[model samples]
Target: MGGQQPAEPATEELTIDQLAAKVGMTVRNVRAYAGRGLIPPPRLAGRTGYYGADHVARLTLVRELLDKGYTLAAVERMMSELPDGALALGVFETLVSPWTPTEPEVITEQQLAERAGIPHNPETIAKLVELGIAERQDDGRLRIPNPDLLRTGLEVIKLGVPLDAIFEMLPKLLDHADAVAKIYVELFRSTVWRQFADAGLPAEGWPEIQRTLEGIIPLAGQALVAAFREAMGREIEAVAYEELGVAPDTLPSTG
Candidate 1:
């Protein structure tokens, strides 16, 4: 008897329907991706085509890239350049996934007025628009891009701070914040990210890079808060000494 032919390596095979369901894509889109050469053509068993784990992984990666604001063409180019492996998928996923998601909450004019504790004064609304605190929608509703910031503004208003004075100071505050943000971003890009890029971003280095980025998110916030508190305390103390004729050092220690 002829020697038994070598057995084919066991692999999970999924039909088009199964593949689409597994990757959360429509069968039509999967077929279209194959046609566009974004994904590998399925293995053919006579008239039927079967997808494997690689196909599922590629589809999932494509979906993630699209979700992260990459255009289809850009995604295709990226997919083409990436080596065929799970590591490449992981790298792109980590790099492209949003650090934080900001979904704008829509509120009606009446709701916004209630939140801000202000009447529907056109002059006040105009000032808010100019200050970038809120935006008016075409549908007549208002969009508070950062509700937390709006709430803070309202609190300041409640404290009897004139709206005009607050608006006048906002530009300077934003300018300083922007400068600080630029410095931090440039520092990361020049030092950490540049070193990684220069070293060719080896596959083994991805975890460390990811961890560094994740750690920076919270650390950066804490550093900014601490620095702001220290600076504000000094300024407050100086103002009190000059205007109120009271030295901060002589005041009872809160601690």
Candidate 2:
């Protein structure tokens, strides 16, 4: 009775409704999360259960990670070994946040269907959602998570290419890209971040690293494009000779 005060709110104890509202979670979700140990179980206070802000904050983190394609099991592991907020925010800004944009543009399903030149069937849209390429908003609208990739898919479809072929190549392409990206990441970690930490200038390092990487990327892209063109030319020549019995010298050359 003495603990229940009129003007002073309990900082350590929040009612279920207050907890849900504060954490941006539904009451059902908060209870479910408590049951699943995603967040710590609330303490019993007489007839009412109460949670604290730490639980609310942790649950919010779990929800963010889930929205970023993390499984609950993975989130559990991450929560167990949580990094400093600065590092977490750095990673979030650098990697996770770039994938999702918040600009709202109104477009009908028919517009997307017309753009892709395919009937927008429920199954196809669902497949895109499941693949994490697109999202369905609570407002009954389709959110194109990455318009560039969607545009690429549309172009591929326009060229009469089957999605299965693209799907097969996509993983291989992404694996190669990831491998290349890791080299630079290591370079940054070793050279830039390490140097910054050693010099006690860690706060200023990431932006400098970002600037250096920004300069490196376009040059790397041009080199990659040139290498791919030459390599693909050689491949086409080899295939032509093997399959068609046509030598490059024997064919009419373009001047």
Candidate 3:
């Protein structure tokens, strides 16, 4: 019934800098996104660009799309085809939520197959290499493509899921997670590493920092495990109850 935005004064428009700050992106990135058609082009007010609330909404939509499984290129195309903001946002969020990379690591193909408890066959090994989950080296042994994928795949195997199914989904999950990680990788470089170098931290200081992060690793892992156990228990119980048509409280006592 109105324009793409609510009734508002055009004079209240946000400049490129203002929009970038509001959306947690760099002005360069905002310009790049506009140039690449990731967001709608801003209105030109003289030599400067001005955006509105609608632009903010589009940025949020792009974030959600990237979080889901949409590549920037895919998002560019999808934005063109899909005019319904709410529906697109919902779909993008759902796709992005479950996808993330496993840490990168090097493990032999045989080791990978063994850990997954799947038969070690040349064909399967070749397939893993082809899918980029693992790669074959010059010495005729394969290593995991990424440490995160290695860890996640191991967890899935431990959960009793078939290796084939796990392999099938790994490619998709790793791709999305890796894409999301790009932003933080840049952040770490720009903030932590650069700041450390600027402070004249000795080369020896690097090892100490590694040790510090490593010391906290176990604590972080324990916290994650505790949270996972609680969440998984609740989810499993709810799913079982739904399937059995029984209330959680009405289930038979294990004791």
Candidate 4:
């Protein structure tokens, strides 16, 4: 077992600065999260207000999720779901973290062109930014928000797929991704998350919730890939048969 985190006793009084320092956060950030109702209101003592361990737990979760690339709005939404305002760190992480984790990278304009085999032009960069594949930081550099996606794009480009074709595909792909994401979110929210919320977030339910979610995340990812493989094969084969007048049954077996 790892060393136990030395958290403040539940009843320990903490000034705003002390609480911020204890949680390794800035006072401004703590207040911002508090304003968003991501944390419980501090207890007011006439001219002074004080935070406690509850604040620590909530802020810690918020900060951790944000560090994992979740937007603040998303963190606020997830925190708002917990009626009891308590969380198991592992369960929360399992619930929200991306299944195929991607570490983002920053690249120069020329590097983007070199790696992606595209021209180092403003129009080309604009297209990438528009596609949500890259982001333009204030420093005038490009950040690949999803490096795996960039790699995939580069592979497609290497196969002689024109950037225009890729650009055309990107929107449709994004639309489908959103649709698929919605389906999974709805299924899980309706079947699992809501039930947990309805149950008043029982203390004993944390472990079970964590285990169930750990299974769901990767299973969903695998399911998407498998389903797409099957569907893609079918679509391509249909094109070969219908458009190209190829006999499906006479084709050589790929497997």
The positional error of residue 183 in candidate 2, measured at the CA in angstroms, is 2.7
User: Which candidate achieves the best TM-score against the true structure?
Assistant: 4
Query: TM-score for model 4?
Result: 0.78
Candidate 1 lDDT over 1-255, as tens digits, reads 899999998999999999999989999999888888887888999999998887888888899889768899998887775445465576555544443335667888777778667777778777777887779999988787767677778899889898788888889988987898788779878999889778876767767777777677567778988888888778878888899999899855432
Over 1-255, each residue of candidate 3 has an lDDT whose tens digit, in order, gives 555866665555899999989888888888888887766777887898788776776777877667556798887876775444444454444433334345446667667778767767888777767776677778877666466656766787889897678778877866865764564446555765577658664444555444444444455446656766877777767887889876767754432
lDDT of 2: 0.68
Local lDDT at 115 for model 3: 78
Scored by lDDT, model 1 comes in at 0.79
Q: What is candidate 2's lDDT per residue for 1-255, written digit by digit as tens?
A: 367556865576789898888878899988887777666667887788887766766777767888778898898776664433334334444554433555534455667778879877776666666665667878777778667767788898889987667656666776887887687568666975577657754544556655655565566667767777877777777788999998977755332
* lDDT per model vs. reference: 0.79, 0.68, 0.67, 0.83
lDDT of 1 at 111: 79
Clashes of each: 0, 0, 11, 0
TM-score of each: 0.66, 0.52, 0.36, 0.78
Question: What is the per-residue lDDT of model 4 for residues 139-174, given as tens digits with 9 covering 90 to 100?
Answer: 999888789888998999999999899999989988
Query: In terms of lDDT, which candidate is stronger, 2 or 3?
Result: 2
